[model samples]
Target: MSIFKTKSFWLATGMTLACSVAGVLLAKLPYVNLIGALVLALLLGIAMQVFPQQVRQTAQPGMAFISNKFLRLGIILLGFRLNLVTLARAGVKTILVAIIGVAGTICLTYWLSKKFGAEDELATLTACGCGICGAAAVMGVSPQIETNDEERKRENEVLAVAVVCVMGTVFTLLEIGLKPVLGLSAPQFGIVAGGSLHEIAHAVAAGGAFGESSLDNALIMKLSRVLLLAPVALIIGYWYQRKFVRRSVAQHQPTPKKLPIPWFLAGFILTSVLGTFLPLSAVVLDSFVQAAYIFLGMAMAALGISVNFRVIFQRGGAVFGAATISSACLLTYMVMMAKWFF
Candidate 1:
């Protein structure tokens, strides 16, 4: 087949790009986003899941590509916004805050969820989703969590939805209530929200709610936290690989291979390093950042489209609850960290 002569390819890609455009449009609505367009696109995708037969037949491959490949491209482009000099001079506090917040959330969430009797996969997924970059983090770490049972796989899927949903609600509510309750300054609250919130959308929304400075503070903190995703994945992968190896040896089963570093992390770092020296115009850099948002929206939509709501509700209610609790705890930790840092 000639490269330009495939019906399936055109149809799938066309659908993906169209969805991304819709996402971009929706992002323009006023007061429609305490959440970002990425989340709105996700909601749209989930809504479309009710018509899965048509979607599966025509658009599955392209959706998968956007969620995986395009998402990685966005993460790399994201790096263009960060420079080492900026990171060193102004970002140190935010980076420290992000590290403590993300790292603590992961460990605490995992332990708490297990204590509450969630499955290993459910616990792990919840921790990553809440601890890192919401849907994106969950997607990044997902390659490592292993389960043989059909029920376990389903639990993982439902838990992802649960994590996203809970964070969405909580982060939104926090935007309205946290400052009043805590009496923190805008920058302080922005730091807390960005470090602690589940999705970048939530953090940005929260920041926007406060003002431009808050928005900047929140984004810087959130992106710094995102920078941690690679290290977290490596830690999780190496630990899980070791644990799985020992267990397989005991059961006389073939050991599984260790998880590799996700390629996007490398690209992300490359862009960040290049950004320090690129001297690109602010207009050009802004365009890259804007495009990254669209790509991320499409990726989120792809995940939402894959979910089966009925099955998720029936099988993963308790798993969802566990994730919810884990996130709640993380929010509390984030608030404290923010107050101290700011």
Candidate 2:
């Protein structure tokens, strides 16, 4: 049956659209904007569980479409948000800081989360979210994980997103509040916020407190980390494949065949390259950017509906602690790097 002709598809799509609009509006309000539109949409998605059982049963296919198909599409569109030219303008020193910060945060967060008794999938997801672009990074790397249990996979994804949201918001506010005490110049402060924070939105909120130069440099610095997402995801995919192969051989089990690299991720990289080099008009670029936001909003909303709150409550404490420790360390590291490099 045609997806468009299915009543359930429209019902589910309509729910997502309604949630997206509400989330965007809520994000624009004072104080609430700190939570951001994506997070707001996620919260609304979680609330979808309260609807009638018949509605949920019928909506399953459409919801799955948004979660899987829209998610990849959103990630590809997200590449348009990155401009190699702007990232280059941020200077070599700032770029190096971003690179080191991402690497360090990932290693530290993953190791610590594992030590705290997190499963491999949970630890890796949280680490990626912290090291790169929060929920987007988590979602991007998720498909690479070699998990037989689909429920467990979705649970970890939700937990990782929640951890990053909480951690990112905490650091965002701290950066804003510490601006007076730090006494750093605008660009330096921007570097610290962009290099340290989890999400682009977090960096914007924190860096924009300083001024225009701060906001611009902060975005470029954030994009430096964003640009690394493609490479990091590829590395994770390769790592997982090798690890799974080794496990299969040890157990004398047949190795499962999977793509060495996710096709969607390759598309992401290609889109980024084209967006960077193409002579696209401002209007066209802006439209693409808007589309990206809507797609991402819907994707996040779909993921939110799949969240297992029971699992989160059961395993959250240790993982949250791991994320908190990693965030604190990354923030300090960025501060030192910013002071030295700037």
In terms of lDDT, which candidate is strongest?
2
**Model 1 CA lDDT for position 132:** 83
- Each model's lDDT comes to 0.71, 0.85
Task: Estimate, for each residue in 1-342, the C-alpha lDDT of model 1 and write its tens digit.
Answer: 642355655665565556666877876776565455666667776776676587556766666566667778877787776666665665567777678778877887788777777667777877888788876677677655566664455447445745675666576676558688887788877777777777777777787788887887778787787878778877887778888899999999998865656677778778878877887888888888788777766676666666566666655555566656766776777678777767
Candidate 1, poorest ten consecutive residues by summed lDDT = 150-159
Checking candidate 1 for backbone clashes, the offending pairs are none
The regions of model 2 sitting more than 4 angstroms off are 2-4
Q: lDDT of candidate 2?
A: 0.85
User: Any residue pairs clashing in model 2, and if so which?
Assistant: none
Error of 2 at 142 (Å): 0.7
Candidate 2, position 25, lDDT: 77
